[model samples]
Target: MIEIDTKKLVIGMYVARLDRPWLETSFLFQGFRIENNHQIEQLQTFCKTVKIDEEQSSPLVSFEAFKPSTGRLNGTPPPPTAAPQDQKARFYEDMAQAKSVYDNVSGSLNKVLTEFRLNNYIAIPEVKSCVQSVIGNIMHNPNALVLLSNLRSKHQHSAKHSVNTCIYATLFGRYLAFNPEQLATLSTAALLHDVGEIMLPKTIVDKKPDELSAEEIAQSQLHTQYGADMLRKITELPAEVAEVAHSHHERIDGNGYPRGLKETEITLMAKIIGIINEYERLTNNPNPKLQLSSSDALKAIYALRDSCFDAGLVEGLIKCLGIYPIGSVVLLNNGSTGIVIGMRQDNHLLPTVMIIRDPTGELRHPPKAINLDKFRDKEGKPILLISKVLEVNSVDDDLRDYILAELVTKNKPM
Candidate 1:
């Protein structure tokens, strides 16, 4: 740790330790990055010197200078046109509409990927069209698509991981307020980020990703180069597509390959894809022994922050998908197994849950919907709270299956 005056701190540096007791200050996070001048000014107001751990610090980034994903100016995020409650309601209302868009994306993207695997020329426009639909779904109300994606986890198609990565990257891009054109490009890059894996030896390509051993991962690194060269050779695709394919494995701390580019040397888009791609791989493994729940996977990524990924972007990821994101099967204080269908922006702890099992673990038909924030006892105390976030695989099979079936048949988790 090095002591530095507040004046010397830059935008992306993670402040490891403060000069004073954390309780004495109003800062919500004990350790954080100086995202804007206002934060630097706050530090300047609070302390003269602070400790910086260089390993955890990211070099200065000017949002205006380079937008890693959007390929455009990173000005202020556009203001929200609708209130938060309206946005939450939109998720429920758009399920049917979102389903149609999702079906189109999965079906068409699969065909394109199949053609690619067969060494047939795949049309760029078809892939772009799928990404366009994803961008639209994300902009409208991401939760419907979010819930659908969670339910579709059982589909077991080869393209499922890529599709999840595309949807999530688009969600994060929308959260970052990328314009439609920028989002189209970002989503397209995300969808094709792993296209090179199709060219690996069938023995390696055929195995579920989680089953790949350490040496197998090393052998597969060439896929990054292959994917980049393949995408770059396509006349119609944008340069960023190739760039992401080439660099998504590149880490900020310089440990990644095949190029081992570090810090700002990796584009913002590549970092975004890297985070999403890894997150998808971590959470979506079909092997029950290997699968991680959404929250568990985020925690794993959190442990590698600054070393493997950007701290701010990692925080943005957690922010985009709340602590117990929708579809997390959780055990509540009342001893019921509930699925998190909606999150409360006001309080991350208390979400809108669909109780699939009764307190005795009996299946509940048309699982009861309860908004924890509003579900109060007669005396007005919060009656039910999430006790723990359960791993999706750990949940009773009967309960998980019932919820998925009901959501599809009834067209709502509620």
Candidate 2:
């Protein structure tokens, strides 16, 4: 089977895979021959691409034959509108609020996980409260919560991963303009996406793939079902939340384990969680060699689009988090180095950065915050452009110390 843009799909072609889950729509079979304009129109509305059985297709059309359309697809719910200008003026305040929210959620998660490890029944209300707090912050400003999530500690991988995934899933949902009710469900599902891992032996979860025996690999993959079962036992939670736990590991191409469920079989919320889960693991893998930088993680996910994830959702993630996401360490064209603190809505590539090192390679005692979108040199030329993204620990100086100090300084009362 070969992948083709949905616009290139024609009557008489056999669809082997859709960009979305098969069960979510009305398609009768997992694979079917497109027989009429109605089928093509439906496919176009829901999918950006589909895998076609080359041997089963009629005459193939050139990609250039089609043009991309803008705006949300027909029959799809509209994304949440952008925050009002008055609300956006409180970005700093929102960010500060997000920090407090992050701390509370983190503490609550730690306590909850401790209980789970002891096989104690979880306090569903407490977990729900934390999820609500995260949702509140995300509703105000998702960027702040997302930045905190990206700066997670490696020591608390499992707990932090859960928190980060929750934040990211909420942010992605917001970007898609999901209603408050939808956002809440998505956040709850993400918070417990990895609960099954608590039942697995640490040695197995953390083992290097090369070192793991066949049986160890199988045992490790059981976390999805384990987590789903645990969530189902919580009678108060939505069934969709439990489905997210079960299907977050599933892929668009039917390669994922536990069930190998493909497009349309997986819920949209699960697909969002799956994308973020893979991204978190890629960036925070225990093995240094396996860990990817934020930019690299995005690239890796993009590379897997259509096969491992839906193409449309992957694009949504990239747009939600700018090209150089918050917390990304980058080198500038003028020889300065900095961590991205804010993204310019009008120009994603030009973010607000805190310059930590000067062109002379000297650490600035008071790091300079420059909004690349508005920055210009004495000659009226742009002063700095991001040359490349750097690894989290590439520099000798401690980034967390500088970042925190900068945030505190910026948020200081006049």
Worst 10 residues of 2 by lDDT: 61-70
What RMSD value applies to candidate 2?
Answer: 14.6
- Those runs of model 1 whose alpha carbons end farther than 4 Å from true positions after fitting are 1-93, 210-215, 377-381, 396-398, 412-414
lDDT of each: 0.77, 0.77
Off by over 4 Å in 2: 1-96, 206-211, 377-383, 405-414
- Any residue pairs clashing in model 1, and if so which? 68-269
Cα-based TM-score, every candidate: 0.74, 0.73
What is the Å distance of residue 289 in model 1 from its true position?
1.1
Clashing pairs in 2: 20-264, 21-263, 21-264, 22-263, 22-264, 23-264, 79-177, 80-177
For model 2, how does the per-residue alpha-carbon lDDT over 235-262 read when each residue is reduced to its tens digit?
Answer: 9999999999999989999998779999
